[model samples]
Target: MIIRYLGDSELAQVRRRRWRKVFYVIDDDLMRLDDDRSVPEDYRQRLLAFRQKRLPDILDLADVIVAPNERILEGYPSKKGERLDPCYVTVCDDLRHFDDYQTIRILFPGSRSHLNDLAFLQEGLLRLSAAHTELEIVTYMGANAPVRLKGMEQIQHRKPLPWAAFQKEQQRERFHICLMPTVATPFNQARSINKLFDCAAVGAVGVFSRGGPTDGVIADGVDGLLVDHDVMAWEKAVGFLIDDMARAKTMAQACLDKAGLCGNPVRVRDFWRKQLDI
Candidate 1:
């Protein structure tokens, strides 16, 4: 089984080779293709001008089309012959081992590209560290992390490690949490649910913005906490968990239990197999 990404220019390459199965990750509505095309002159008004003859051509070539999340799947064109399904995987390193520290650790900073927006998380961390003198806040340093974070300077910063080491380290901690604050935009609205799965798998409490696909998975005050995009809210939430160890532990256990049922890789794979009819 060879997996290939079918993009605009790369769709033709799949035909050159033969494979048992091919998967394409579809992310847009076929009806909205005109909005994406480069054809000038009243493109919005000329919606009918751009015939969708090429859509079937693309779909016919694909053996299986995978949508990463429910949002992506919802946006996909549903037709009689089309076979679209959610077959996305959370590609984070498996953290099934390690049992050491009893301190809380937090992982924020969405991606390397938007480190500036993530600076607030570092600020929150500083405030957290100050209130709890004995707390150990481990910050995973991404390859593109900024030089410094206020109040986190004293907090231990570990270089990005191999998947095995990283997962081992993550599981050793008492709790793990992810804080992601996405700026309001159509593009940001398309965020993936993998972060929730990733944090849940390791029994880490997940903290995220109420926007995007997070709402579908995280139930505030239930499985995880949802915060407004304000730094104060983030700080308060983090502090609450850090101060209340028992509640944090319970939430972590709940996350682990839920993740085992819903985000299990084997279960996810079986879902894909059923969807793809393989």
Candidate 2:
């Protein structure tokens, strides 16, 4: 399994390694970097170069390309003409109880790459916060979190964590709701709802963008909520959860139940075993 963004020397070393099967995994939306202003120019240039050049070589060498969804596979077509199951695969069991809760907790659980998507929800978040004094918003963006929003008494920001640490933290802490809002760009369009899995892993009700991958999958107003690009819509979805804590708690458990069944690691392992024919 080769996952890192390696330099030429490292790439050559990877090629020289002896292995029965090679896998390349892409857990992000790597499309239309030039149009995404949030990405720094130099870094964007480097990413684009890698996407155009090194990606082909890596795909050619990889026995299978494991990705979060079909859109990514379509965006970066492989010679095999197929993509593996996303394999985000799992759920959290010991979920947080909502009874006796004083404050409504909401969190934006994403890395710097998701800042643009999170920003799309800023106005709505502000409006929602204004309406409810008991609401507490936690963000993982740290110093990079939106300045205006971070200054609010209800908003608290934490520094981004390493991948392993983030997963552990997801298990440790609990929030009532998780937010995923995205603007319509090729970059955002090609992304997956790994956020949906994250929502389940944290055992929180998810509020997703209507046109994104989570749209059809979420079963809105049941296990989760879906909002359009409208700021009022975003505010409304969250407001629904705040107004009805019992349903909100039910939805969170339903979301986790769905994840455990749909994203079972055992099922994933079996699928891969069959795919590998071993």
User: Candidate 1 residues 93-116, lDDT tens each?
Assistant: 333322333545566524332344
Task: State in Å the error of residue 192, model 1.
Answer: 1.9
Top lDDT: which candidate number? 2
In candidate 2, which residue ranges exceed 4 Å CA deviation? 7-10, 17-21, 38-43, 85-90
- Provide the lDDT at 176 for model 2: 88
Lowest summed lDDT over 10 consecutive residues: which window, candidate 1? 79-88
Q: Candidate 2, after superposition: displacement of residue 223 in Å? A: 0.9
Work out the TM-score per prediction. Answer: 0.65, 0.89
How many steric clashes between backbone atoms does each model show? 0, 0
What's model 2's lDDT at 11? 79
